[model samples]
Target: MSRLTRTGQNVLTEAMMRIAVLGGTGLMGKLVVTAARDAGHDVVIAARSTGVDISTGMGMDAAFDGVDAVVDVSDHVTNNAKKAVAFFESAAENIAKAERKAGVKHHVLLSIVNCDDPRLKAFGYYQGKAAQERAVEASGIPFTILRSTQWFEFGEKTVSVMGFGPVALVPRMLSRPVAAKTVARSLLNCVEQGPSGRAADLAGPEDLEIPAMTRTILQRRGQRKLLIPISVPGAGKAMRSGALLPGPGSMSAGPTLEEWLSAR
Candidate 1:
């Protein structure tokens, strides 16, 4: 039996069942794991820490033995197209193989919004994401792909990598960043409801620029640093044009940027 539940505006019905989360120890995965368990579902953590390596398909078969669904929140952090493509494609293939053998009913994948836009072609990370989508489509498994905008927490992540001694040079990009917690909840909702080819794109309430978002985070953290937003030739220019922002049909959720910072 299923009951109606809401995760923002969408009305979904959920049932308790066992589910496996690949990369379950990572940021998004950890959130999904906790949420699913709290909701009365058996949650399996399929990650290297748990001996199930999705990248190499190690221990995947046994880990997914009786799992009803699998939420793949695995990520490959790289700016190089080649490395990103290699990691995502291999991981997707491995996941497909394991799920096939285990007869996992649903495959939920977390992805980025507008990753396949021609304007984002130069962005290696997007390219790899696109490849993963294709691999899933060809995998012959029932799946749900949740494409989301950058998360609010990404501001802090960017600051860490882009900061120099006194200044942080971030890409000049437009975005509608959602809270990571919001995204995690949405993913679990997807898991409970079963496969829907492409779920609505999830984004924050307001559109924002990357540099300004980072500046706000820096101010909140009490870190003094000059932020310089530079336009990269291809991906940067595309993002500045709002290539990464959500469309009209996308589902919007909260804690706005300011709200997210205040709570942190």
Candidate 2:
């Protein structure tokens, strides 16, 4: 059954609780904050911009004050492997430290799917995420870990990351390309459920081929763009194998791609 169909005053009364989003300013964070607030939860937006840097522990003592649970969607923008490791490991340790001090109960997160699959992981991005999950699991606080598919916005961002002599090329990578809002809503449900210690992974209602989604966006933008899909060597292969797709009974019944686009 669809979660939305089951939602009502009863669900809201249960789901409406204090929840903090670590990277509330980011794309996924934005949707989570809005969705949680719409569901009647007391929401706190924590980020460097909001005076909370989890990695350095600056402003954390004050930021987590009275926070019921923490949803960490924070990310560092870096292709450098060492930096990724530092950010995630440090941030995980700090979150555990501050939460221990504050006595916060649950620490939820939106982690990438197949994070443990070595072949699909990029340098330290997956490794860092794995480290973070391990830290939280070892912390003994009730936690809910959600592995999610790639975001639709990621495709948009990937397209802009190229400057190959007036031509843009997509990494011959594969993705499920679920909407950010869908991911947000699913994570919120887990938050309201308290802590499940790694809940079921979530994906979109439809399986969208990355190349097709990219082409659709390009067409919508009125750019007669040439998108070259390159079969990347390592992690790319894992992604193509559907490592990020959700498992059975893991997805919420939500609007399909056409329905979502129409509503937007």
Candidate 3:
């Protein structure tokens, strides 16, 4: 049996592995790199900025050389379903090929919870995510997919993109938002545990309205805005009624939205 010890909120394992982090420059990606390094694991960052592009499969062979496992945190932010599907599918296919080439043992993907609900089929982003999941499953590689709820920072990102001076059209949806750092720690924990396919969903402690959360975020930034709740036909309608919420047996933890903001 392997020995384990607690370090703050993270569990450090005695068996360290050489890990390759795809999209290692993004918010979650950077956190994973830090956590892995802090836990004494060697990390290789595979990203376009580092000359490893997953889109066209360039520069991946060298990046995965001797990598014991691969963690994919690649993301494309878009509401256009076709575009989102294309991006994720391409990324998945390329990453799968590279993993096979490098003979990597384990593959981990960070995805969204409830992304495959029939109600969300019309939502382009979720549709894209579903496609990516299917690709990963068919890749013939040992893999684990950890689906998580939206992060607390999502409120800030929504406000930034949807805000128009004193008015913001926030999505009419519900979410259990966890901290991005917390999610990062969970991903690395999954990495150490090895491949287990479709790990338990990860969520935050509180159930919240998207618009209300965004409003609070705006207030924290000293911006008072007229928040209007807008609904879409399919996925948007589902989200308002908790379609995005985790099902039974999800792992819900927190530093809630307020607590996370205070810490920042």
Candidate 4:
């Protein structure tokens, strides 16, 4: 029996799906789970901590038993091309096979914006994401791919990853940093709306400079560090060249970086 629910102006009439969220304990995954459960759907947490490993297919058959949809927010944080490719490909394949067997209807994927740009291929992580998108496309299950821009949380992490001694090596890149909460809401909307193939790109309210964002982070943390802005040669260049920015007519959401930072 199908169920009906309201999301913004749209009323979703899809069945009350038993949605299995891969990496359901992670940052974004947690939000997705909460949203699904709040909407009166059965939410299954699939993660390494939950004993459902998507990469190896262990315990997946049982997990997918009555699941109507699978939202894959699982992620492997790596910059190595080979490792990133291996993880996403393996996980996608395993999930697709399990979903096929379980007769799941929708497979929702969370990916980065501009991941398919040739200019960004120099970065191993982007390469892995591209491969992950490919793997999902080839999967027989009907799917929806939500490509989003960088998150506000990523700003702080960039400072840590690029910091050197007394200085932070900030890239001369532009980004529209969306709130993870906004992203979570969007993903849940997709889940309720069912599969839409390639949906419109999601982004933040304003275009921001990477170095300025890092500086804001330093100020917020009360750290006095020299932010050395540099143009990266390959992948960095692509990022700075606006390859990571969302295209025209993309869906933009709050809170803006300034507003988000001020509240934090």
Every model's TM-score: 0.92, 0.87, 0.92, 0.88
Q: Ten residues in a row with the worst lDDT in model 1?
A: 1-10
Once model 1 is optimally superposed onto the true structure by TM-score, how far is the C-alpha of residue 81 displaced, in angstroms?
Answer: 1.7
User: Worst ten-residue run, lDDT, model 2?
Assistant: 1-10
Candidate 2 vs candidate 3: which has greater TM-score? 3
**Backbone clashes per model, in order?**
0, 1, 1, 0
lDDT of 3 by residue, 187-226 (tens): 9998999999999999999999988888887788787789
lDDT of 2 by residue, 106-173 (tens): 99988887677767567457777777778778987889998887776665676778636546677654
Ten contiguous residues with the weakest lDDT in model 3: 1-10
Report lDDT per candidate: 0.90, 0.77, 0.89, 0.88
Q: How many backbone clashes does candidate 1 have?
A: 0
Ranking under lDDT, best-scoring first?
1, 3, 4, 2
Task: Give me the displacement of residue 16 in model 4, in angstroms.
Answer: 2.8
Q: Candidate 2, clashing residue pairs?
A: 172-230
